[model samples]
Target: MQLQKLLSLIRQAVDRYNMIAEGDKIAVGVSGGKDSLTLLYALKKLSQFYPKHFTVCAICVDLGYDNTDFTGIDEFCRNLDVPLTLISTQIGKIVMEERKESNPCSLCAKLRKGALVDEAVRLGCTRIAYAHHKDDFVETMLMSMIFQGKFYAFPPVTLFEDKNLRVIRPLMLVEESQVKGFVKRQEFPVLKSPCPIDGTTKRAYAKELVAQLQREHPGTKERLFHAITEGKIEDWALPGV
Candidate 1:
């Protein structure tokens, strides 16, 4: 997507959820992938004109994978003038090597997100921003259905009462294709996933299933997104968010 359209979609989500308030400090969880880098870049630009005057810091928790270098990501953050803190961890080793869990995604995700929350709190941030987009939202809902037999998707905004940190997804309105185009058009120094099972997960299955359904039912994705936005699921509602 063009820069203007990208920012407009991000702003739409931000405004809809009351995500940013004046004097809020938000730490964006940047995994260095296309989605995360796009989020970091958008927030960096949005900071200049966003009325609330929020500050952002980028944090990425490395999953202890070999041959994973964040040099380009560091430079990219530097160019955007967003401070980045790369925390190295043994999450990959613990889950894949030590635990040898068949379902590593659940454990690894919790660990990485916990680490990000800790770092955000350490940096005195009141909020955390995730790079989940429209596709991710629908894919996650489908995953829940196929795996857990539930109808649910993550909301645009969430709160962590224990950490006193609010989680916001400003890119909720942007599609995955748009995100990819934005990164390509802007030449973002994106980082690919270093995880061994990156594309061979239940989530990947959900992605493929959604694509297939979209081919059969042309407006499948849009209808799913509408259901999410229309509060078909109890948790998808904007109420008390």
Candidate 2:
């Protein structure tokens, strides 16, 4: 069932964004989290029957936090027979000791993303794929609107100039709940975020708001997802028109 859902999502993202091509080397960012691990597994399964010729490699960046063991992740990757690369940085210590800000999510995310992209480029990967799902995209949209006063969310595909890498989100059609359920069913090894400021963040608040909306409206998530994919807002006129 997970494989079927993942195949459908892959087809949707590929058709929508033209993300993959024949003979594309893709690197998947695996943080030992449910989302990323699921992405890696799905890609591994898809590669077997994918019409186009493509390759996938798993890369993990260690933020150097105390009591965080990557042994389980290493073993899992070895068992899967996928090549795994580990990059280590002292991001967690730096954020806890030097950063005076209360919320460290943005900074940590930037650092980790940069490191992942660099690794992808260094490993000669033309495309880098992340595990951002439908809920993440919606939460980002809401966060940008409420906090940044902007009407933008993370695109399904983006090209980075510095790294010259094409970044894609294949799980854009899958919901977070589905991802969590799949992870639980598969018993994927999950890594905890070692940042001192994990729970107290603006994104957390936005996520709560989305959850409340989901509870209030049964099919709101599906409708919102449709609006995104179908370009429902393109018909609306801008202010001062």
Candidate 3:
């Protein structure tokens, strides 16, 4: 997707959810992956002309993995004039070595998010922008239904009451496919996850499921996403009722 189209969707989602407030300092979680890197670039560009005038800080929770290199990400952020903060943690050892859980995506995600939020708050970020796109939203909902037996997806805006920080998903309207195209056009320094079960998790399953559904039904993906944005589930209605 072109940068103009990407920013248009991002601005739509941000406005739709009232995500960015005046003077909000948002920490863009940089995983050195395509999704997060796309978010970082989008937010940085948006900050240049966005009316709300929020600042951007790029942060990454390094799980102490040897295969990943963040030097390119640092340069990317530097070129955009955004400060990057990296939080190093032993989450890989804890999850894979000590806990030794076969299905470690859940615990690994929790640890990584916790570490990111800790640093974001300490850096005085009032809010954090996640890289969850439309495909991720649908996949997460599918995961919730199949595994937890409930209908739940991430809210566009979530409040971390304890830390006084708000979570926003500006790229919520952008699709995963769109992000991949953006990454390629921009040559984002995408890194492959070194996790043993990276592609074997419930998310990967749901991704395939969504793709199959789209193939079979022709419009299943759009319909499912409509269900989300139209508030088919409780607590998903847009702000201001």
Each model's lDDT comes to 0.90, 0.80, 0.89
Clashing pairs in 1: none
**Comparison by TM-score, 2 against 3, better one:** 3
- Candidate topping lDDT: 1
Give per-residue CA lDDT, model 2, range 157-186, as digits (tens): 777767768888889988888888888888
RMSD of each: 1.3, 4.6, 1.6
Tens-digit lDDT track of model 1 for 1-241: 8999999999988888788888888899999899999998999899999988889899999999999989999999899999999999999999999999989999999999999999999999988999999999999988888889988898877878898888899988999999988888999888889898989999899899999999999999999999888866764454323
TM-score of each predicted structure versus truth: 0.97, 0.91, 0.96
lDDT of 2: 0.80
For model 1, the superposed segments whose C-alpha errors exceed 4 Å read: 236-241
Per-residue C-alpha lDDT of model 3 across residues 1-241, encoded as one tens digit per residue: 9999999999998988899989999999888889999999989999999988889999898898786788898999999899999888899999999999877888998998899899998999999999999999999989999999998888998877899888899898998999999999999888887787788888999999999999999989888988877766775564511
Clashing pairs in 2: none
- lDDT-wise, the better of 1 and 2 is 1
Residue 156's lDDT within candidate 2 is: 75
Model 3 off-target regions past 4 Å? 232-234, 237-241
